[model samples]
Target: MNKPQIRAHGLLDLLRLVAAWLFYSSTIFFHGSYLSPLLVHGYPEAGSLAIYGYMGVNLFFLISGFVIAWSAEGRNWTEFAAARFARLYPGFLVCMTASFVVQTLAANPTLPYDPSTWAANLFIVAPAFNRPFVDGVYWSIVLEIVFYGWVAIALFFGVFSRWKLQLGAAWLLMSVLNESVVHSTALQMVFITQYAPYFAGGIIAQHIVAKGSSTEALLLLAAAFLLSCKEVTAGADWMQAHFGFSPPLSSLLAANVIVYALFGGALLLRRRIAPTPLVLVLGGLTYPLYLLHQKIGTLWLNALSPAVGRWVALAIVLTALLSASFVISFFIEKPIRKPLISLLLPRLNMMASKLRLDRPA
Candidate 1:
């Protein structure tokens, strides 16, 4: 394979970060005012410009798949899992803790903390098991975990080696049936279709990287899809009507694909663009912004909306979110990432060695 060509997608990732901030800020702005035109009841955009952010999450998953495959190509699956846990869990736990603390302080007197419920969030499994949307953004994290677990399982069963195409094909079929399966039992119906593409796209992108493919055209297409795609309104009745198949499934699939493509395109761009310190720094802050902003936004909306104009409140919240996310990313997230991985990797290796020795194989 030829040396991978670096593109300008890093810059695009930074731009996406800025876009997410604007979307979220708009959500807060619109939601705070009953008269705000953007606030349509039941539409996700009613709360924030998260229709865009949802695509961004798809991009994140694709990036994860691409980066993980590229980074851990020949490594043990356990190490990859550990790396992901270290990358995501610590920040998640911290943010969840902060959310609970704020909730305890700010909620109506009648609202009480349920330790059992809180315990579920600490493990990041609550959202997966039909639990309430704690901190709102946690649902995506749960999905991310599910995606990772499926990938790990695929790797374990040697499905990845024997039939990569078959794996994707199977997932696509399940995704097609996702809506129907939801009726039987949402718990057992793990349709891999909705998510497999993002990861698969990442894997494909990695191959492109390895082959030194030019990504300019692909990147442009992704940008167009991301910016121009239709958004689902907060309380869309279209899904309720169900036109033969679920429109929810169609829309969800579309949204996920658009986002995945955008990220794949971004990867090509990341290498082509000149490295800039500021852009890189902002891009790095995305995870913390993602993890912390929901709680921060909720708290800010509750505490500050009364005193300031809706627009002004929105500005303040956006500023605080970006500022705090950067602080956490640089000071907390970045620092701990390396040490946590370093600490965990050795213990995992030791356990793996012990298990190997204990077993005949």
Candidate 2:
């Protein structure tokens, strides 16, 4: 049996940290309404800047699709599912539990509600029923699960069995359909749009490997850097007012997909840089940080606005939450993830071996 190696782009992780920090700080600075004892007004430019930074989540999804598809290449569906679930669920469950407990304490107590809502959150399927969001971040996980199901179906049909063309087309079509017809930016983004391009990008990178071209990786890395800085709505004051392209799905997708592809390439190219253990640790902490940031921001913004000033308070809170998230990921989340995976993997491997062995021999 071949032992598996864990791979991720440390540089991308660094970029994610920057964006996460920027987004929270900028959002609080920009939105006075979010600040407790709120100022009635916010700087419009700051608001727009914060919104632009929110595109980072799309980049995250793309990177996820690329990495999972790249690493799980030629692996069985069970293995793929196990790997994704193990990486995503443990940290997510902990965060979800924390959010529910917090929300219950914070929210109005007069409303009648069922305990099953928390149960649904545990399964990560509460979004399907239009349940009230437990945390702002949980919605993204629901969408990610939908994306995973789509990947599983593609794998089931032996899509990756050939070269990556059919897989690319399938993802592309899903993206186009989501963007043009389904017309739900939130749904498309969460369910498929953002991930498709990243998966395709990774497939392209993998193809370059098969063809023995090193420049392919370099080009992708450069593209990622360029795309990350692309402000999709830059100088859109007149256009935002006159054109009325509310929500800006096409523009957002354009920026996000490019960024995702670029980062996907950078991650693939990291073999040359030889990332340090600390970089790897930061990369591992990203998911927990992603989950906790917004809720922490919301609470801090609400609690500290009058005392510390909105923007100043936001920066302080974001820093503390990020530090806490790192601790949680390293100590609590990582520990749980390793043991769960260890316990489950052997059973999965045995099952896979049996299925493959029973096929012929």
Candidate no. 1 TM-score: 0.71
- In model 1, the Cα lDDT at residue 130 comes to 48
Off by over 4 Å in 2: 1-47, 108-114, 154-158, 181-195, 206-272, 346-361
TM-scores of the models, in the given order?
0.71, 0.72
Report how far off residue 200 is in candidate 1 (Å): 3.4
What's the distance in Å from true for residue 108, model 1? 5.3
Q: For candidate 1, lDDT tens digit of each residue in 114-216?
A: 6765777878877454455457667667777777777666655545534544454455445435523553345323543445455555654554555454464
**Runs in model 1 lying further than 4 Å from the true structure:** 1-56, 108-114, 127-133, 156-166, 179-192, 211-261, 356-361
Per-residue lDDT over 1-361 for candidate 2, one digit per residue giving the tens place of the 0 to 100 score: 2322334344455545544544445445433432323233343445434444545655555555545555556666665667677878878887777766665675723212356767777787775665655665676677677767766655655666463554555555665566447867776655556345444555555445444455644455334333323333332332466435334546655655555555545655656765677766666666777777655556665667678876777677667776877877888877776678777767866886777721210
Candidate topping TM-score:
2
